[model samples]
Target: MAGTLTVWKFPTETGAETAVATVRDLRRRRLITLHDAAVVSWPAEATKPKTRQLRHLAGIGALGGGFWGLLFGILFFVPLIGAAVGAGIGALAGALTDVGIDDKFIEELKERITPGTSALFLLTSDAVLDRVLDEFRGQSPELISANLSHEQEDKLRRAFAE
Candidate 1:
């Protein structure tokens, strides 16, 4: 059987929690498969700094987003000594935060997410687009389908063939 792989595009502003929650509810009712619920996220502000200095956060991801959040919280508390330590910790956090997604990763994703580019993509390999369409209907109302160019699709086929 020929399986259709759908790369559904969505608004970059779509909240991860909301999307996941909707899918989870649908799954509970057996409307879709676990595979159909897969998700990948790119910044909504693809061209701008997202979350915070994300463009420069290749330094932060290495330290892990959580670590910096912790350091920042610690810095916020304490007293006068906290100010100095907080600054140091924040510097470390910034350095750590800058390490997650590198410039190349952002550049690649951003190019794909240019003003008229795909903002979000949720690919599923199955023959149930109708089911998906019905399930996600009105949920992500602004989400649109990214029509892959023939060249793009052909390239994909060739890559998979190899």
Candidate 2:
């Protein structure tokens, strides 16, 4: 099921940073999917812009701390549980880190945050627009985009065009 669309405007200097932060923020909000997002404007990468955009890291501190803390808690109360869970998590994180895209992904994300761009976050879910929009509106970023169907995005676009 789906509901009316909503969007949020978070100021940033780079479109790349906006994408990263939007992904991270929505995920934290328990959103599992994003319909679409585009950088309407971005400073040419070759020329560094003077304005700086606010940045957000995905599952960064919270995710990191939660992962490690879970292991510690289990380890403290249940040695076997801790050992198994800790090893599992460590391995997954390691594998993801070892993957070729790990460094590049991080570097790219870093590049997005440099300055003076804004990120528009698009969300698709069953929840009411006000439920989410109210929260972001309170934060007052830049502009929020809502309810993006491929049909609406491009008159000729079909459901599976992507």
* Candidate 2 regions with alpha-carbon error over 4 angstroms: 2-6, 14-19, 44-117, 121-123, 127-139, 144-160
Which stretches of candidate 1 lie above 4 Å from their native place?
1-4, 15-17, 36-38, 47-112, 115-127, 140-162
Q: Write the per-residue lDDT of candidate 2 for residues 77-158, one digit (tens) a residue.
A: 2334567666675554444342221434334433443344544433344444454444454344543333334334332122
lDDT of 1: 0.38
Q: Indicate the worst ten consecutive residues by lDDT in candidate 2.
A: 53-62
For candidate 1, write residues 49-138 as lDDT tens digits.
222212121211122334323432332232335576767754554442233323343334434433322232232233355776676666
- Per-residue lDDT value at 45 in model 1: 45
lDDT of each: 0.38, 0.38
lDDT over C-alpha atoms for residue 134 of model 1:
73
TM-score of each: 0.34, 0.33
Cα miss at 32, model 2 (Å)? Answer: 5.4
Considering every candidate listed, which one attains the maximal TM-score? Answer: 1
